[model samples]
Target: MTERATTSQPTPFATRQLHPAGSADVPWWRDAVIYQIYPRSWADADGDGIGDLPGITSRLEHLRDLGVDAVWLSPFYRSPQRDAGYDVSDHRDVDPLFGTLADADALIARAHELALRIIVDIVPNHSSSDHPWFQEALAAAPGSPERDRYMFRDGLGEDGSLPPTDWLANFGGGAWTRVTEPDGTPGQWYLHLFDPSQPDFNWDNSEVRADFETTLRFWLDRGVDGFRVDVAHGLVKDPTFPNFGKHPGGLMEVTHEAPYWDQDGVHEIYRSWRTLLDSYGVPERIMCAEAWVAPADRLARYVREDEYHQAFNFDFLETPWQAQPLRAVIERSLASNDSVGAPATWVLSNHDVLRHASRFGLPVGAPRPNGIGADDPQPDAELGLRRARAATTLMLALPGGAYVYQGEELGLPEHTSLPAEARQDPTFARTGGLELGRDGCRVPIPWTKGGASLGFNDTGAAWLPQPTSYADLAVDEQTGVEGSTLELYRALLTIRRERRLGLAALAEVEGLGDDVLGYLATGPDGRQTLVVANLSSTPIALPEGAQVLVASGELVDGQVPADTCVWAQVD
Candidate 1:
């Protein structure tokens, strides 16, 4: 058999076949750091106290300076402002409150010019009840195809006394909404996983699936790089509508059927959308899922090559400020995703959660009666800054991509309290005001020190109150400081780009300490970088023989003193 033409070395063709070019080169998504901007609170150009597309466009340079490769803008689609714009009445046009469609186009153009890709949020899981399609369904004859677009049925018993199934809405109400048909029937019901105003689309219906595909194409045609799919796991629901059984408190538990909601068949839907996006000929376009599920293995499925490019790994966001738990989550995430053929994406906070500084103990202020207060004193602020920088350092040192929530770079803490009437989050209302509303985290970004609403806008009160102390933390104020969080972020981002970290490589994490975390990033070229973070309240000694490339605090002889992080070139 001539030994299959075996030579001293394998032929190039054989090697190529063994490791394809597509497998070798990193996806544009892997090494990129995505900055998430909540449009309603990012910046306001019109003095309306609401951030608009033009406002975002004007701030492009600031984002560029931050060293982010892309920006993920939260939904600005036309809506009635229910659920903070997640209820979309139209997917194709920009909301008039945010700006005109022309403004969106201009923002995209300018973003691309700055070499930053823009990804918009797409809410395919549901639409505002005010949407034309929903209105038509509401008036359609019972059992008509239009009504089938949503989950609708007659009341439970012949007497129409109960819902078909007992399921709780995420917003703390019955998931099933009673609706009177055009004929004035008293027992009709519709399924809405969230607010009644946001009806869940029936993905089982082929028409609904096709409509989403069209929606994806709509944005791709309009020059959007990709989508941050809202409630990606909520698209599919159990056809059986099984009851989740009561909670221990007997509050009529309803989320038990969640597993069925994120069915594997949903991949077929995502694949179809991916196919359309691929046809658009955009390079490095990405799709990320806002999935909240268990079994890291199951979450990994959403980011497989055939599904979304990435899924937000929210474990860190929920993890408390403890070293052991944090390390375990990171390790498990790396292991699970590596085995499942998907890259992990890390985030400390987002529009829905409390800011990192507050969550992680960065000085914001005393916890006021309404949850408002300055962080701790300067020492506490410095300690918090150290932790924030360390968190990012650890995130970047990991094997996959990392996400930076807007305003996080400034060590921004959550602002929980608002006047009783100004609070708009449903979480608070539904929980009988027990839940700390998310409005604080949603405050407008402070751009300049005490300069006209922190330069967010030239208007009255912002949609959410601007933090009174923002004057000190404004970007203009911190930009000049040598050891500011902003500067640390810039340095890390530059290092990420210059190093060309691939998504597939497993990081060798080690050197764990009681008040510090450390790891090493190893690339295909055998290059290695050492990362160390001080998780303590005071300064600590740094490792030897490592050249300091980036440090969150002052560097001393290639060492990072306490409450700091340093990225050192190992080889």
Candidate 2:
């Protein structure tokens, strides 16, 4: 499509609905390496201080060279940017801040030329309140066809003055916002799950279902290999719209049962999407869920054979850096996905919460907090980097697909000390400084050693300021340094592919201390790779005669150092 080529053939394992490629008979995504690009912070091409499509195109080679198989780009669709680009106004057009539709075409072409797959972000859970449908809904009478496309109901109090339910906004307000009719009188309240600027779509509406299906085809025809479905689990809510007794919480830390997410109807929508993806005939498209639901088994439902291809493993990402919890999450994820014949996707830092580097450095077993302000206790940077590197090495050797967020390879931590006035995340503004927004991790990345924007922009202008400390961790500075974090990532990726570790079978090796994790990755060709991660402060003895292929840190007398991981060729 659009002259960008793709490979697709009927795989012998038809039950999998996956196409095989490369020298190995395995599906490309089974153990693929996917890089996530938070568009606004990645690079700025037009000098307006915002990263765009051309900026991302200019950096495609960096991904190719780093050995990643694909790029899962964050939403660059036309939007109000209220929740960044997640509040999409148009599914078919590109945001001017990111570039035009033509630029998107060129990006697909360039990525295909480099043999890299392209995955675009699709936000079906909600649309920008400014979207045509929502705008129409605002003008139409309550209970009309326009209003039916979304959830609109009468307020609970006298004369419909209050919100429809007791549900609280995930961002700290009423989840329902009342609309004003043309007559200047108060109208029915509408559902927003997120910010007031982003209205949740009623998935039960046939028009809504048809519109999303059309949106999928439009992108597939443009040659996108797949889509990263934003808030995938939140698409279909309970028909009754029952509110929990307490104020409704966020998708992240819902330790209790909730009706707002991971509903059964959501699976039917994906099944339809899957059928539509297969309609293309040959080149099969893939979809990954950003579903943060309860229970390992509930999350697995999103990736059944008839639904999406991959689901991000938030369980693993949210687990503490300690060994046992991490090991348990991994085991549970593998078992859950294996039951459905789908690959479990792994991710660490994204355009979301604090970067794992800083997160690991924090006190172990602490609650997952969002913002670490200037007044917050600073993280141990050295310890964080050590753990981050070791964790990356271990993740690369895992037997499934993995996602790498930008600037993470260079050991970039969250810009925790950003001033309040500089904050851009809606969560911060809506919560009145009580909750730290995602802006810290979304800060502009450093690309070069010297420049006002650290080579991210020619004008040294960025929408979000880059922390001065980023100058030392710039990509140009880390490009060739042997022990640099960038090199560690490149080497780990190179070794992973060369050894086919992604397609290998994993067997947990016991007898390691409670604080240490070890696993054996065995290839079908008889090649054995042992991966050991030392999460404790004490060093652990390494296997004798297992030649070290690569390591996160230096070993002392055949002992794996604390917070270090090693990939060894077993004897």
**Which of the numbered candidates is closest to the native, going by highest lDDT?**
2
Model 2, span 1-571: residue lDDT tens? 0121121321111111111122357668778899999999899999999899999999999999999999999999999898889999999999999999999999999999999999999999889999999999998998899999998899987798977677777777788999899788988999988899988999989999999999999999999999999988887777777767555544455622567777788999999999998788655688988888768888888889889889898888988888989988877888788788777788888887789989988988888787889898888889888998999898888878999998899899998888898888888988899988888898888989888899998998999888888999999999989999999999999999888887766667666778988877765565777789999888888766778999999898789999999999875
What Cα-based lDDT does every candidate model obtain? 0.72, 0.85
Backbone clashes in model 1, listed as residue pairs: 363-375, 363-376, 364-374, 364-375, 365-374, 365-375, 415-440, 539-562, 540-562
> How do the residues 181-253 of candidate 1 rate in per-residue lDDT, one tens digit apiece?
7888775688887789998888889888887788787878888888899888778876777777432111112
- Poorest stretch of ten by lDDT in candidate 1: 13-22
Q: lDDT for model 1, please.
A: 0.72
Best by TM-score: 2
In model 1, state the lDDT of residue 491: 78
RMSD of 2: 6.6
